[model samples]
Target chain A: MVSRPVGFEQQASSGALGSVDLGPADLVPFDDRGLAYGDGLFETVLLRAGAPVLWEHHRARLALGCDRLGIPFPCQDALDATWQGDPTAELEVLKLILTRGSGGRGYAEPESITPRLLSRRTPFQPVVKRWQEGVRVRLCNLRLGHQPYLAGIKHLNRLENVLARREWRDASIAEGLLADSAGRVVEATSMNVFWQQAGALFTPPLDQCGVAGTLRAALIDQGAVTQAALPLGELSAVDQLWVANSVQGVWPVTTLFSTNGSRLQRWPLPASDPLQCLAHPLLGFA
Target chain B: MVSRPVGFEQQASSGALGSVDLGPADLVPFDDRGLAYGDGLFETVLLRAGAPVLWEHHRARLALGCDRLGIPFPCQDALDATWQGDPTAELEVLKLILTRGSGGRGYAEPESITPRLLSRRTPFQPVVKRWQEGVRVRLCNLRLGHQPYLAGIKHLNRLENVLARREWRDASIAEGLLADSAGRVVEATSMNVFWQQAGALFTPPLDQCGVAGTLRAALIDQGAVTQAALPLGELSAVDQLWVANSVQGVWPVTTLFSTNGSRLQRWPLPASDPLQCLAHPLLGFA
Candidate 1:
């Protein structure tokens, strides 16, 4: 095992001091592997009353990502200390980005890595309207490529999602649903998706592609959801559908549109979605 | 088309003041989309005697990537200015990174983007020995996922290459060959692969996946190479094999090993390889 650099520990602790503004302290070296090759992972945590909701889940996922990429996980004390902030805001968004640090030109990892953890806090923009009254989502023309090795972890290589999200600029369309190259349903642009069939909850299996979200994990752990392969063709037959993430709680998808902007499927307003009900409290949603 | 931001032009022109040191001027803001979501493209140009090799090919690829991603291409005047440097070094590596500048916290791009172009020049470490005497390579277990939309563009989402490069630490192994999920030969960890079959040169098609190397494009343009779907199983039947990129030129594969380190195929030293002979002068190799 490669030994962690002492300088990294010190730098990380101090850098984790957290930033409210994009000052000099918030700048990363231009050669950072994160920017050069997307060699990193990130977490977006919702801060309610200054406490990070589902902090443990975020931490665990980050650790998992670090392990998969072979980057040394930063000290937990440093992370906790960095996460500490004033309890003034009613709601905030804490974004944590962990990168393999700066490296010389090439794809090889540096002899000794100085992992950098950058944290920024911004006021959370509430999507209560979408959360209350379902959202309209469309099937993206872009299909996600399957790389099992990089699957499930929310790594920094997200050009696919960026391209997928760029498919729709219509304000009415809240999200774009992505499918694997094989036509299997994966996830939405920034959230995990779930559908109900015969009163059973099912979400796409992420072994091939797509991120395994924290909110989706909590539901599975609580026995409210099961992993299954949902083909794009099978979506129209599902009873109910909802999209969720750690910060956005759950937004029911009321309308599904084809790539050409014509509606393919529509569902009635979710009067009471058991899946959303089970997730709202955990995500700190009203 | 989105109107190009004036600040970006000013920033690009100034930021291109080539830096040999990582100073405050060389730092990228943490919120830059390149670091956040790998929303960027990059080019590694070889400088032999202070002149960039295959410059037009590199510029065209970067522009193609920007157009594909809907990022406003940086002004050509700014890019040309940024590329100017003190023509002193015998051999230098110039890396240009163009990112969809800083954005608010989300996958959806900001209403207006200020694209950032980062350039750095470093002394090139010539792999003369690897170039002279063919190098040994092995097949990587990590298969590249096929994303047609992202195929062929040398974008910043290169975690696959990073992971594949990390698979083997044995310095003796010059590079690792990667195959697509369908077991079709794609490329090496950091270079493009070409092999001779019945006296015809063939390289993998980049439509499904793989970075279409500028050097590879140059070779193809000259009719020295043709694109074909190469199955991994057919490597043993090939008469000659070589891996190449702009910076490293062409390195003939002396040995090919399986993922487990067992010899899968071997090729005799090229007493006179026409492909390498065709590529040597273009790559500034003796």
Candidate 2:
């Protein structure tokens, strides 16, 4: 486990990098935009071998999200300084939160936006082995409120995730799956869902809800899966069911239970599903 | 303006109250519930005399919120002990935040919920005079998402409020008003709305959205105003407009403008309306 202090660090002169300690006083000032408006985007990257598993994708998506939220583009040099080129630090899980720095208390953002980037590292843990054994899943009763404008992107306004996560207390059930207001499955508490359908891989399209998982994004890029905007009825027809997120990597679902008393047994992926030969450098499992 | 340390006192087992030098470390032990799930409720009470304004009402609401959230109800005697008889601690503000004391990752709240309650005092400041002069108002473009299950109670999932507050940077405007997904006016960014119409007072019903402010609750109870579900377009017919919240009390709106270029004048509560005399004692305004 990473035994580092869990406080704010000093910002470098560029207002981007360097170590600054943060406390409650910093909460309201670190851009009330972040706290007051959730006007920010964040990425959680699993670092292995001194580099983020999908660093490029994480950075690119963060940039895209920043653009969407109107936050200024992040500087590479400042971001590089955050790592300090410590190759041994690859064992850490980094959570990078970029906020549109404090501006007027109102919503109209300032013309020149200064982004607040907080990069912190925690001890990394791997959950890939769990996929082979599979994990239990429960359906969350709290349906995600939909907003097409904010779907797919990882913006900070996550009260819905917070509420969904609070629905159950059973630790054995690794995750909760959420549906949109219309009862179409969206995602797990913090992961994206995918299923093997008709001998091909299918995952829900996030255009209407759910965060677009980086691992899922990578899988799609590799042609290992196709995006399907399927409703709940189609879920029963799918074969192997799995969930993936940055931190968790991927985990197979062995059991699923719905509030309406529907039960689905485990659907294992076929040998042709490409789980074995996926060539992302971070997919180190042989 | 109140000038004092932001952190509050934590009474020792000796029953002596001493200022707790709580920084980030102290807040950490309080758990992940408050930050992670927003599974809590908070109260910000203005202090006019040595005591918190409307302590009973605030306490009652906190209790109600705790009951609904499944948090343990705190001992009232211990809560009162936090304030003691320090009625002369100088005019200050009291902030109380209660959380389902932290445990369990990902939403299955712990069975034995230990509610964490914090009471801290800061100096008090009232901009009540600003209400008479009337404050500039703007309508937020970001709409409050609907969740009937979570409405009315002051739960921590406040990303909607944060997003709405970030919609503008114009300091000239005092607050931004928000509407629900159905496009009905609900409340101001941090306050509740009440307007004068045809010699009567009308405030939007909180049954579906927005917080039920203590001041608004009191006015409705005292036969001082009528509470009804009103729509955004209905405001155009109002005789005058004002916003009420726990901290800012009642603020008269002199002008209203929608981002799309619609504008309306709302000030000078008609002389015939009893709202002029409806400001409660807890409001500390004439």
State the displacement of the C-alpha of residue B94, model 2, in Å, after optimal TM-score superposition: 2.5
lDDT of each: 0.84, 0.64
lDDT of 2 by residue, A193-215 (tens): 88776678788888866788788
Flag regions of model 2 displaced more than 4 Å: A1-41, A64-74, A81-91, A97-119, A148-150, A221-224, A260-282, B1-33, B36-39, B81-91, B99-120, B265-268
Q: What's the i-RMS for candidate 1 in angstroms? A: 0.6
In the range B101-120, model 1's lDDT, one tens digit per residue, is 88844789988888887777
Using lDDT, give the best candidate's number: 1
The pairs that clash in candidate 1 are none
* Best candidate (score: TM-score): 1
Docking class of 2: acceptable
Point out where model 1 deviates above 4 Å: A1-24, B1-24
